[model samples]
Target: MQLPAKGTPPPARDASGLATLLRTAGATDTVLAATGGWLLSERRSSPATQDGYIRDVSWWLWWIQARGMDLTDVSFIEADTYAAAMRHAGLAPGTRRRRLSACSSWYAYLQRADAAVRNPFHRMDLPKRASKPSRYLTEAQLDDLVMHAVAHQSARTAAIVAVLKATACRISELTGVQLAALGHAGDHWILTLTAKGGRPHRVVIDDDVTGPLLDAYLAERGSAPGPLFATRTGARLQRSYVQELLQRLASSAGIPDPHTLTPHAIRHSVATALLRAGEPLDVVQALLGHADPRTTQAYLHVDQLERSPAHRAGRRLAAVVARRLHSRTGTREPRPADIAQAT
Candidate 1:
């Protein structure tokens, strides 16, 4: 069967658009039943996740049709080729994996709906997610970045940076924080946000530094009943805006490889910094909101330095060795050279 010719783009947000995409790609009866009939009506996912599945499946369908191929007759070799193309396009591993999973899920659902069709993506070797943060700012670099934000005039932007540093919250959490979600909780101010799995998560606003920065930002933002982080016109802050803001901040901060700095990287930086400060691995896990302890352990692989907890532990070992040498050591710790680096 020939693929349907591309026409004027259909209205996408509608659920029927997904069925249209499958029909246009020449999907067989069973496939259509699984996606358009069962999944749309039965699947329990957030609206965003549901839309993402449709959107991702649309790309695969388009690619298949572009090759003048039959979707139901796709062979394993063709699946590998598509996976390779995704890599060659420079999509991140997580992105590639998610897209493949999205399409693969449709095939899985087809079987659950008592229909069988070949899952081209099921056997293909998808991209491997990075075991640890591939890139992140050092604590020193974080200070420099925040300093640049302070010098700039955007109070909202500065508070966003400060909160990310202090709480290690995800960008979505940062953007989702409402004025109503923020409240005082004893020594620390608390922010309530929905976590990754639609769970209630509270981020602590502490350390004096971040709290004060947010205070100034909130003063300027006024007691508005909206998102704590918003644009100049008072609309909710979008992720794209935060990304572009960082690009500008990184340039101003003189940070190397400005594009590498992201809100998630700030999360990684704080996790690493906390681990470096002798914070327990499990505590850091809780701070970052990783439900799995092993996920947080990945930060332990970060290269140890003079500032590492292990290095600090070694100071006592060094003192023992010094006593063996009959040499006196300094009685007190030296004053820290920099106290401005708060996160």
Candidate 2:
């Protein structure tokens, strides 16, 4: 079987394309098609996730076909060899893990259907990932960024930054926000977001900051029922546009590595700030709309370092040292000889 060109897009999400690919790879077309159908039918699977899984599987099939091996004949040895090939290709750890997971899931589905003898990935061990802390802007930096956006950019841009910082919503969720989804309950403003996996959550807006910006933006936008954030022509904003806007704002604000400033980084900044303020993990989890408490716990690790007694003591000691140096250089009592001469 001949593989697609190196840079060709993966097979489309359709029965005919899937069947053709499976047949070309010498895979069980009926079983693989059933698995694909099941994945598409999964209520929790987002479009991105479905597309990713399909791409991963397509790559796996190509790899097997190129080696003159059939997918149905794969074994634990082939799985291990695939892992080695991935490592040899210098794939990032996260990418390797996700790709392996996609293959594993397909094999598991086949096993359950009695179409395969064993799951090739059942006992395979992938490389362990290092725990890296999430990067976020400091409060001062955030303030500066927001101030710059407000002063130099449009009202809508400022409002977008404010909402992201305060609510920690994903960029997709933010773009999906409709004008009608915003409401006021007593002293608080609420935003209803349909997050990943189609989960709907309501979060309060920080009235002191985001509220005024939102009000100003809405006034500029006039009454609209479409996207909460839109262009002058009322077209919905794209995620890439928001990202570029943020990068520009960060650069204008003198933030280091401004290009790395993304909506998720702002979201992480919010979580870190909340955790440092001693907000409970469960509360922060709910606020971030994290499906798992463990995902929220990553922020706690960073908070622990920031709030550690040693870190606080070090800051205090540094301040004391600075004061002592200042006193010795400028505030010490005049030397006796110098004072006598002056007298």
Q: What is the C-alpha lDDT profile of model 1 across 58-173, one tens digit per residue? A: 76777787898877667767777877777776667987798788778776677576664577777667788766545677889888888889888477778888888888888877
lDDT of each: 0.74, 0.78
TM-score of each: 0.71, 0.76
> What is the C-alpha local distance difference test score of candidate 1?
0.74
Backbone collision tally, model 1? 0
Candidate 1 residue 33 Cα shift, in angstroms, is 7.9
Q: Which residue segments of model 2 deviate by more than 4 Å?
A: 1-20, 26-29, 41-44, 175-189, 206-208, 211-241, 307-343
- lDDT string for model 2 (250-342, tens) is 998899999888888898888888888889989999989998999998876665776789988866665565556556575443443443333
The C-alpha RMSD of each candidate to the native structure, in angstroms, is 8.4, 6.4
